[model samples]
Structure formats: structure tokens, C-alpha cells
Target: MRFIFLFTLISVSFLGFYNCKKQNDLIEQKIVDSLFYTQAEKSIIFSADSTTPFTCLSALDSQQLQILKKTSRNVKTNNDTTNYLVHRMYRTLFQNQGLTNLAAPEIGINRNIIIVQRLDKTGSPYELMINPKITQHSTSTTVYAETCITLPGAYPANVDRYNLIFVEYYDLQGVLHSEMIENQTAATVQHAMTHLGGGVLPLTIDPLAFTGQEIDSIMSDADSIPMRIFLTTIHSDSLILRKQSIDVRPDSNDLVLMTLIKRMRAALATTTGVGIAAPQVGINRNIIWVKRLDKTGKPFEVYLNPKIVMTSSNTILFNGDGCLSVPGVNGRTQRWAAVGIEYDLLDGTHHTEVVQGTSSTNFTAVIFQHEIDHLNGILFIDRIAKLLQTK
Candidate 1:
């Protein structure tokens, strides 16, 4: 996506009235300066008119925060159910916050409903979770670095959590069912559950390692070098790599996302690898840059919130999968020969398409799956080890 610069526009009549107009201008400038912009020289997009309040916020306002913290009442089978109100909250969140999905408590609605939009790029699904609960969380814990759109100023912080969880919820038809969600999805559900309890703290550690001084150093050097220190397999930020990533706030987090796209492109240019994910650079957002080997002329592109819709029944065994994070190790892995994907382009457009692996060489499918796996904290090595355990 092209990065567009937005300058706040002031009205002539308002400017004509007061000696404090200049003072107000300075105040506005200060707010903008404190609020947005990454040290990497990234730019934020704002409205042409200064009179409009910022649509995206680094943190929720008093009203919004209060709503988010409110304990939601459960929906009933009767007409008094808060299902409709929950849906309204869902739409309002996307409209105002540009979030991909939200929990019941976050929208000031009944605790019985949650709306999740495109978590992946293929076809968008309007899935609803009515009266959802984590029936069980796997005893095995994994480290994850988490982030939230509500706390935009806070960086992703390391947290320990169950790698797998059994979630029981009602479908749209009001049928109760259970699904085993693992890896990154497990992390997401755990995070949302925290909100349900009216907890303001993210599922993260206090005094984040990458906060303050370390973050400052990284951003200061972002223009000159890739933030490779934050990528997967880095020993210091090990959990950060394995953690599931969150979606960027299209309205608020646009600048950092834009800068990430640029930096990833530049970093990939320096590497022989075909793709990279947001967590590779330490930003835990659901975005990835991949090389489209199946296409000509268009060498590489970015996918935001890509979803894997379908996988070919037939599978292919590749020689091995390698990663930038894992230095010299390549492990044999079986992957789908073809897959259907839904993802958003840089301009925030949705698309659904199929990617096929070559009969003779399945590198294309391998790369696509590999990069997408990063979003869920899955590395090729992890996949390889899992395969071995099954045998």
C-alpha cells in the first residue's frame, strides 16, 4: 500500500475568530506528535479536516473504556437477548476502530455474542460465538508475546499460556459445540477471555523487555537496518516468535503497518528467503510479505489477515523446509499440494484465490504455508517435530 501523508486542515472561519488560533494549532500539532508516528520515520494518515476528532485512538476514551470494562449479561433464548445489541457493537467496532473482531465485553453488549470478521484472507465468514467459554486449556504452556488494539502504545509483551484450548460456544443456530483451538488461535481466545473478566491488563508480563530503551534503539535504526532482532527463533525474544499475532488497527495503527510493509520489503530484498511475517520484525500483527512464485511480473506482495480456506486432499512431501529464523536446519515436511486463501491487499481490499504447488517442485505452496504458519506461531521445525512424534 502506498503511504499517504495527511495534513490536518483548519477552517477559515474558525481561524478568523481568535488570537488563540495559532496556539490551538500548536496544541493540535503536539497531540498529533505525541499520539502517532514511529521512530522509523513512518507517516500516519489523518483526515483532511482538523475539526474532526481522530477516528483511531491509541487507547480507548472514557466512554469506550467504560464500555469495554463493563461486565456483560448473558443472552437468553427469549426476545430480551442482547444478541442484536452485540451485533451492533460488533459493526460499530469495525467502523470506529477498524478491528477485525471483538469480544462481547469490549463492545458494551451482552456477554453472549462475539463477532469475528476475516481472520484469514479467503472468503470472509460472519461467525458468531454465543455464550462462549474456554472449557479447557491444555496443561502444556507456551510463551507468547501479545498485543492489543485497545492498547496501541504498548508493544507486544511476553506471556505464558496454554498452547491448546477447548472452546465451547453456541453457533448461529444456537447449537452448542466444542472446537479444539491451538497455537495462535488459542492465544487469541485466552486474551479475549481476560477481557470478559473485566481485566485491563493484557495477557502480558509487566515491564516488557522490548519496551522503552530497547524499542527506542530499534526504531531509531529502522531506517538503516531491518529489525531482525525481533524475528522468530531469536533466543532473547523466543516467545515473541511463537506467539499468535493480532490485527493492526486500520485507522490507528496504519502508519506502523505501512512502515512494517516497507521494512519487510527491504529486509526480504537483502535475504534469499521468499517471505516474512510481522512477528519476524517483532510487531505482532497479522500481516505477511510473500513471494508469489506462481505469478510472473509480480514477484512479491503483502497479505493481511490471510485465512486458509481449503487444502488439497492430496499432499506432497517436500525435501525440507528452511526458515530465516532457524539458521542451518531444514526438516522434511508434508504440505498440501494446493490451497485456497483469502486475504486483504495493501489497500484494504479482500480477495480469495487458490495457490497450487508444482508437480515436480512444491516450493510455492510450501512458502505460502510457511509464511502463513508464522502468524500462528508455527515454525517449519515445529511442524517437522510434530510429524516425527506421530510416527
Candidate 2:
């Protein structure tokens, strides 16, 4: 993503018109001095246009965008702290505009905003709308610009599109700096309008976390029965079992996440399974509890947003690869002998782990691949089918 920097300096002017008998009231006017930073050009323009209102003025970078998309708003982290501050700034701006009860809109830099420049009637070049409505309240100076573009959607209605941009400012020493935060869209604003159940706060947090009723049902079930498991035998459960899971953000609901981890561990303990995924528990979230046989204590650990980034060329064929969800089924499946995994912990820390070896010496790598496959909506039986097809 590209960055579009705009440093605006506002000067208020009052002009009085004299009539024949009396002096007319003074009219307040605002003049905006805008400076844009780009790789190609850098220029300053003085604008008197007060008709247009800026749609959004702040944005998040690509990394912050990913964090915003993946992580929920329920959990607190260092990144979340930064995002919260930005959100507060937007909230204040919206409130000042009489747009109360609105969620903070996500913003990001658009590629077009970097290259395209629009000229007004006076031939003054302006990349974004210069609205007098936008007023800066913070002591820290802000430098950012945004443009809204409307695109045709698949349906009859047109989709409003806004390219996201990150906001940064210059300090007293003239050093450019930014705080990491995430962004939202206009669609998100509309959604928030309809769903005001969360009040003024943005409902960016994931709602797919396990409900109390669902949790009670799973916990109360017989130890031998996998009540929470979404089985291939069941038609409704199979739908979720076949779908890809979303990443579990570091800021996911702590109570929900801990409950899931506990229930998954309990479910795994019921059987001889080495690992259990959220999909197996009828939740399509990127979470897994795996028994780390390679570790000294051979403990079970939970990995959120786990992904198998790399695999060894050498393959291992397990004669009886099985699954808790696919009970009564065991088939030969080929898996990587070694695999590298990237995952996150509950504390918002990231880790990369490599597990390798034969099934006899270490089955951790195979287990990792199997669980991560579930996150991608792949089943061990599917692997077995591929093996049979090759034969």
C-alpha cells in the first residue's frame, strides 16, 4: 500500500461588506494550505473551497490492515492500543459533524490517490476534497489525504469504494512519525448503522465465537460421545467441516477463546487423538490444540491462526491415518516428514516452529499438518483419496 501525506494549515479570514446605511455582518472564511508528499512530486497549494466535505482523512497501513481484519476488538494488545487511539480520534471527528452513534470508519491509502490529481475550476491541483468541515483538535499534527471512488457492484446497486491510507504527522523537530493502527470501510459504517446492538463501538470483533448454549451442550455430553465434533456423516455439520476457517486474532474474546481451548482439550482427551481443530468442534476458527510429543514434557499447546508455511520434499505414509470426526475410517495418507508452522499465542506473541522426523521418532510434524489442513477445510480422508487416485 502507498502513503499519501497531506499537511494542512488553516487560516481563518473575516470579511465585512459595507452597505449604504450600515456595515454588513462579517462572514467567516477559511483558507487551507495543503502540502502533499509523493515520490514523484512535492508541492503546496492554497485552497478556498469550502463546499466539499472530506469522506475520510485517516488510514491504516497494510500490516495494520491485516491486524484489523484478523484480530477482533475484544482483546487488548499493544497494537490494539494504537488502533483504539485512532478510533477515538475518528469518533471525535464524527461526533463534531453531528454524526453521532457511528462507528469509527477504517481508512487506508489508495494507489490512485498517490498518482491522480484533480483540478478545480481555478486550476488549483488538489488530490482530495478540501472541506472546511474537517477540523483538527489534537496537539499532534496530522498529515493525510483520502479519495472516495464508486464502483459498480455485481447487483444493481453501486458499491462505494474508498482506498485506505495511513495517517502520520510531523513533530516539533520536523520528524515524520506514525502510530500503528487498523482501518474500516463505508460498508462497515452502514453495517454498524443497522446493527447498533454494540452501541457506538465498532462491531469488528468476530461473532462466531462459541455461545453459552453451545458450550454447555458440548461440555455436558458424554465423554465417549463427540457431540461437538462436526462429522462427515451429518449433512449440516459437513458444510462447516468443508469450509475454510478464519484466523483467530490476538485480540479475540478471551473468555470464548479460553473456553474453546479448554473444551477442545477435553474433547481430545476423550479419544486417543493427538490433535483437535476448531472445525472439529463445529467452529470454523483458526485454532488447534496439539500434543507436542517433541517437547520435554510432551504437553498439549494451543496455536491460534496456525499455518504450515513449508514442508519437506520427503513424504511419510501412515498406514492408518484417522480423524476424530471421521470415526470408523482409517486409510493410508501421505504427509510431509518435516513442516514449518507460523502461529500466534494468546498473549499476542508470534512463533515459528519446525517439527520433523518419522512417525516412530516424532509424529508432531504430521499432526501439525493434519490440524492445519482442517483450518484450510482439508480432511485426512481427502488426502487418502488423493493417494488412491495416484495409485
Candidate 3:
């Protein structure tokens, strides 16, 4: 009887422990799913495959470097902190599984070092570098932006980085590793180093003036001075109507794109028109704000790098199409009845969707083609000319 009783007690204890562990793991998975979804909604979150969305940061401890915080103070400059910094770098790399690289400062290590997982045509592999300094920078620059793990709430910014940089550094074993980095990698390294130097975006005259609240107010208040800057009219300039626009670079211009998107939406609210473009306000970037007539709210959607990749075989007559660029000049024009478009959303995700046109009076397809033409430097007047010529 004593033996049977002991066995029963042990089994009960083991079952309790097993159940507790299972519950803890389930809770952890929920947290991870929530974070991954949040990041996907707010920023340029990407994965090697669409199926795997969760990151390893959720399994890590609070003190781990993967957690976003002010990382400026953690970087060490000398050889004394090499072993500690390298260990921290590897830990950070492990914690941030999908990340291409990590900086020592990010993980709370006071050492000027970055661990990068690089792949080129030649394949140099994952390596560590210490005390990196930009010895030379190219005269030309590029606009790039990225989301940081630290500032989870903030959108990416249009940051200026050298197109090419000659960097001098030492490896993990204290050997020299000097190289010239160009293009995307150069931009990434420059962005990470900015964190080491204690710089963050909304680099403004008044720090308090640039918070999330202020931005919301600016976006919401249509008559505000900041909003007025984006207000354009037919008489704005020939450049506004004729200049071709370029794609807004995702590398460093995300904040600029966000601000422009907000202002464009606000500007559109004050007008009776259904659409607006970036060049209309003197910015030559390929962006447009348009009302979604098919949607219930009639919400304005921003499109970046928008292009009509496919169109229907049949043509439709747009009898009356006017523009904010040319007032009091409505004309009949020809357009594709159906269009398949690809554009970048605010979160930097690319999407392709088909907008179907009806034989009745649905103008969504017409509006998309119209705004997209503006990006390619085509005006409504040009369409009228083409129609007349074809006739």
C-alpha cells in the first residue's frame, strides 16, 4: 500500500510540472505571434518565406540585446572589451535570427563592432569587425531608411548615406580588415553606425515638436500651415504638370514618404477631386493619394512606385476626366477598361491587384490609369491630344 501511494504522488507531481511547462510554451507562442503581426503591420517586415512570420526575439530574455533600447552607451572602443563584445555580438546575431547583421551598441555592449552575415558573388561569409571608421565617402548620396528594433513605434526616415564608403577596421582576432563598401551594404552599415553615434530621426530644431502626437495633429488638421505646403492648384507651375517623377527610395525616404502620404490625404480631403500626385506639390517622387470609391469609407489610399502592369484588350471611353493639374479642361479620352497594378504600400510591402472597370459608370480603373500617367510625366491634356490625333 505504501509503495502504491508513493508512485501515485510522484506521478501527480510529474504531471503537474509537465502541464505547467506546456502552458508556459503556449503563452510564449501567443506573445511571439502578436509581436510578429504588429511588426508586419507597422514596418517593412520580411521573411525568406511567406509561411514563417514569427521571430526568435520572443523566446529571448528581457535583458537580451534583441530588445530595442537606447544602445549608444554600450559600444566599447578598445581591445580590452573584445572578448565580451564578440560574445555579445554572437548572442545578438543568434537572438535576431532573420536580421542580416547586428551592432554591439544595439545589444548593450560598449564596443564599436558589428557582426554581419554577408553573401556576395564570391561568398565572404559571416564575419566580425571592430573599430570601424569611414576613411572615405563618395560625393554622391542615396536616400535609404530602415525600421529599428529600438524605436518600434516610429516609421522609417529618409536618411542620407554615402553611395560608397572606404571603411577601416579590425577583425575579431585584432587583424586589419579594410574594404570599400558600396550600394545597399554601405547604406546598411552607415545606418547601424548612426546608432553607435547616438543619432535618431526627426532630427529637428525642437525635439518635443516631432513626437507621434504632433504628427497626428498635423495630419488631422487640414488647414494647418504644414498641410498648406502640400496644397496645389492648376496654376502651380509647368514643372508640376510636366516633370516625370521617380520612385521614392525605400532605403532612406520612408519617413518622408509617410509625411507626404499624410499631407496628400489631408490635402485631398479639402478638395473635390478624387486624386493627387507628388509632382503636383513640387516633389518629383512617384506617389499618389486617391479615394477608394469602391470601399465603404471612401478612404484615401497612398500608392508608391505605382504602375499599371496589365490592362484589358478592350478600350473604354472616359467622357469627362478633369484633373487638379488642369482646371476647367475636362475631355473625353480612351483608357483600358481593366487594369492590373503593382504598388508599394506604406509598410513597404509590394502588392498586385486587379481593378475591374464596368460598362456602366465605375471610374476606379480610369482614376488609377490617370494618376499612374502623372507619374510617367503624362498630363490629361496629352491624353486629349492623343485622342484627337487617333481620331
Candidate 4:
């Protein structure tokens, strides 16, 4: 993942037009005159570009004067999902011209795009079009200190923007309109897009690719652990992953799963342990190790072949999640706070349940989803974007 330098290209004709701006007209240069660049602020990725209108926003949206409000637009339960959203936003956004090359990214995320400089029919340096989300909004906008990953190790430029921007966007169906947002949400949306070229706003270029950081390492007691019932217990080393689903089941995979249920019953002697998966014992399987968190503190009731069916549109992102497989680490993730799931128990019994709330912390969703990836042979590390991420 490379830091995409979107505005790097300039047509020979534009060089005539790209004369130096007057001192007072520059965003970063203006900040420097204030003598406000602190040591910390000077060592980050931060900058801004000019604005290019996509839809000709209504210059007369009366909502601009109101105070900023908050919403759940960009909050995701895990880095994987966050990365997914950012990546798609790029591919969907197109320009009228200026694309010299369009190679797809391997560790792809479309949120931040690198626009190539190309000549239009008139032989002038014009940007391909850019579509940016309204990440922040309020009736009144202000720009503040901003950073970027592309221009690494630079000073943050103090800037101002609309307290809230009523951004116009489309749904899966393509109908378009605007939305208002406040505070950090608004700022983040604007900052990520400025890196594309034109529509100059204060955004920091992140040469760094992935967005996740290593909050901490998960700890484990030992390497090889116990095997569950319904499935045969294999070592993590023994598992062969192909993609994101389960590739192999044990000789008596169903029995191995049942054994997990029995263990849940035993572990439930005092409280619910619900279900168990092979990976909990150091083996990786697409299977789950979950049991409903009993209302009255019942033992964990085990289930097999669990699948989420119906779910509400409302999702939440929170922190402090842990996982049994990737031990010693916990962080935030985006998950459907409430989800409906239908699955089968070990005894060939089918169960329908709705996880109306989060499994645990944001990290819990990461872990559960991580385990699901195991079913298809996926890992958390593989999905991480190189930008703004930790080890």
C-alpha cells in the first residue's frame, strides 16, 4: 500500500497557470505566519487542497447556520469494516477526465484515492472528477489543526471549515442528497477526501496505508490446549485455510461440535459457557464457540452451524474487545448492535436467536468476525489497511 500522491501531475499548460499564490491566499503558509507550529504538530502528515464541486451543492441550504450534531455514519465495529468502506468509496467516485492509469490495489481500500495528472481535450491540466463524503458538518464550519499520511512528518496546519457541511451523497440505489454533521465526524470526512486532488480542504496525506494499530498483544496460557467434542481438535498449525470459509472438518466434525456443547454444560455448572470452537484450543475452524449469554446466568448452551439471518440497520462501534485466538489484544470494531441469527445446535437442533446487542466490546465483534474468517481461512492481519494503523 503506497501513499497515493493524487495531485502530483501537472500539465505543461497548467504550469503557466500554477504560478505561486499570494502569501495571504495559502492555507499552510497562512498558518506559518501565526508561528503556531509546535514540535508535535510539525511532525505529522497534514495539508490541504482546493475544492472542486461535484454536484453543485445548493449554495442556499438553510441548515448551515445551525449547531453541529452527531450521527453513526462513519463509526465501524472493526478496522476491517472501516477499511472496507474507505476502499469502496474510492472506486465508486469517478472524474470526468485525468486518469492515466487505473490499476486495482491488492490490499485495496477505496476511500483515499490518488488522482493522476492528465490533459483534457483542451490540453489543460484538469482533475478527473472527485466525490467526497461529508464527514463533518454544522451550520457554521471551522477548520482546525489537520494532518496527513502522504506528506509524512510535517507540521499540522491550523485551518477552518464549515462547522457542519450538508454533504450530498447517494444510497445503494443512487438517489443523491445532502447530510449535515458536526465536530470530528465532519472533519474526518473532509480531511480524507482533500488528499484526492482539487476540492482543496485541510487533509493530511497518509503515506502509511493501513488504519489499524496494535493496541496490545493477546496472551495465552500455553500453545496446545484441549479439544472440543463435536469437532476433532487440530492444532492451528494443522489447519489449511483457502479463503474465508471453513475448508476442513474433523472425522466426526458434528461430534466434535457436540463435545463443545457438553463442555459448555460442564463449564455451565456455575454459569453459561454456551458454545466452544476448535480454535479456542489452538485449532482454527470456521466453527463458533459461542453460547447465548443467559439472562439468569445459566450455563453456556452450545450451538453449531450458527449463521446470522436478520439484522437491523443500526450498528455501533465501541472499544475494549478481546479474542481467545489472537490473545493479548483488544481494540474497537463495528458491529450490528442488534442482530438476528439462526443456527443449529450440536444435537441437530436448529435455533433462531437475535443478538439484539453487542457480543462484548468492539474487540468482541472483531474476534467473532475473525473466527468467522477462520471458516474461510482469513486472518485479521490480512485485512488491515496500511494507513494510520498501529502494529
**Model 3: per-residue lDDT, tens digit, 1-391?**
2222344456557756777766555554443343222332223223223233223231124454343334343222333334543654566566654565666555443335676665432674556666677889999998765555444454544467889999877665555678988887787777667655644432222221234543454455443223442222535566555778777643223344466666766666777888888666555668888777767786778888899999899988788887776766888888888999999876778999998754334578888888898888787778889878999
Collision pairs in model 2: 59-107, 59-165, 59-166, 106-183, 106-184, 108-164, 108-165, 109-164, 109-165
Model 1 spans with C-alpha error above 4 angstroms = 1-218, 222-224, 229-233, 250-253, 358-362
When sorted by TM-score, best at the front, the candidate numbers are 2, 1, 3, 4
RMSD of 1: 24.7
lDDT by candidate, in order shown? 0.62, 0.51, 0.61, 0.37
Q: Which candidate has the top score in lDDT?
A: 1
- TM-score for each model: 0.45, 0.49, 0.44, 0.30
Model 3 stretches astray by more than 4 angstroms? 1-236, 250-253, 358-361
lDDT per residue as tens, model 4, 117-221: 232224522222223354445556675656432223343445565655655443322234455545554554455444332332343332221122200111111
Indicate the residue-level lDDT of 57 in model 1. Answer: 27
Which candidate, 2 or 4, has the higher TM-score? 2
- lDDT by residue (tens digit), candidate 2, 1-391: 0111121111111112223122111111111111222222111011112222223322134453442233112111123322333334343334343232222222221111111122212452211111111122233332211212210111112223222333343322234444221223223222232221222123222254444554565556544444467788999888888899887556443545566677777878888888999899887889998888898888998999999888888887977778988979988888988998999998899999888854755688878888999998999999998888888
Ten residues in a row with the worst lDDT in model 3? 51-60
Candidate 4 global TM-score: 0.30
* lDDT (Cα, 0-100) at 274 in candidate 2: 85
